[model samples]
Target: MTTSTAPLPDSFDPDTRRVPPLGGFNATMLGIELRRTLRNRRTIIFTLVFPIALFLAFGGQEEWNTTVGRGNVAAYVMVSMAFYGAALTAASAGAMVAVERAQGWSRQLRLTPLSPTAYILTKALLALTLGALAIGVVNIAGVAQGRPSMDVGTWIASAVLTLICTLVFAALGVFVGYLVPSENAMQILGPGLALFAFLGNVFIPITQGSLMWHIASFTPMFGVAEISRSVLTGDLPWYAVLNAVAWLGIFVAGAAWRMSRDTARV
Candidate 1:
């Protein structure tokens, strides 16, 4: 009699799970994102041109080459340019959410079999693919500059990190798009990303050889850029790993919280 009643189950149906068909959903969203990105000439350029332009402009001259110093410029351009993926995806995808909300896209999706979780996953997946494509192009351009010590494994790891970064930023984009006017997304997100890239080690070394560079060392972009370069060069800085993980956790929590708040808007 003492054990007649058991604790309530964690969920209504403990034996069943409700995880989304993330793989298929991700694939579907990726295909959609690719088509959307390709349709826009500007997106194509940002994903491909900017990195190569910077590489050619800076990676070519002997003075700039020497200034690129110890093969750092090639790596910096390669790594820093990956941020464009996050930037572009965040700008478009975030605004798209707001547009969809206003046009009742969410209502259509909700009425169908598409679960809310699946919908969110789709957005994140689209951002991840765009991130990969943008960053992958940058890396390919990098290969033209110098072989360095990079291998398939290095590139693979970098891609994984870049995708994670994209998803995290996409979440933030979701929140920002929800909060700000859809029209202003480009102005807000574009400049924010540019500033991050500049302050971080994208264009130059984070070590900047100055104590005033303290800000870069502590930023999210710095963590991303440092880890990206380290992984590509087979250096693997432990501190960058810790920093990235810490930022990922904080970013994820904040984004999720913000996303939940927007549920009412739709």
Candidate 2:
């Protein structure tokens, strides 16, 4: 009472404690995600085995020795199989996001420093890597066993075309993964893509002016198949290019919308 109490001590405000940025791109995280995608033994094995099997069955035949555009029948089939395998691998890698989402990893990541843009870019890169691996494996098999007789230019062009086409499927995979929260992702995508392949003109060349041809011409895979194989034929139709571009846009938009909606819900 005679004197005033000592001045109150300064104290840190617990509420003012700094938190690191909640979201940012990190190369280390991207590397880890890529490694995780590549480490999936089942996917690697499938991408390798299935394409090789298809090549041996359809391409390694005496009957396939006939000419197809500039390359032989065997070369055509080999290119188709290589493209198919790459697409499948990319899609599967992207769809793995479904498992992650179902396990609540996305929600947890929202609490971390990983931004949605970083997350999406990582997934797209992983899908592309897997697709490239698939293409490499299949093409190696083609050169070794299928004995494709295409020039270096054709080989390079076909590889590049197939790589570009895989982007569409990669986007589709992401879209499907975000839409489906269960492990049934692959189950749905596997058969659905197979149908897409069949109708897309990858399996059988659609006869011109026929009903099936008209339907296949409009299908997503048809455009990719046509454009990718055009390297061998040296004929890239405007419609085929349009089709590939259109489907790519649709899938990319769908994936973006779905991802945004999903992250917002968290």
List runs of model 2 lying over 4 Å from the truth.
1-23, 263-266
Report how far off residue 161 is in candidate 2 (Å).
1.4
Report the lDDT tens digits of candidate 1 across residue range 1-266: 77688856757765665655552365665676568757877656655676567655645544433323234444445555665555555446645666666666766766666666777777766667666777777667767667332355656676576656655566656766666644465567667766776776666554555774776766666676666566555565676677677766776676567656665644
- Compute each candidate's TM-score over C-alphas: 0.73, 0.87
Among these predicted structures, which one has the highest lDDT? Answer: 2
List candidate 1 stretches off by more than 4 Å: 1-30, 61-72, 83-91, 144-160, 208-211, 233-239, 263-266
Local accuracy of candidate 2 as per-residue lDDT tens digits, 30-72: 7898788667787876588887787678786776778878888
Candidate 1 TM-score, true structure as reference = 0.73
Cα RMSD, model 1: 7.6
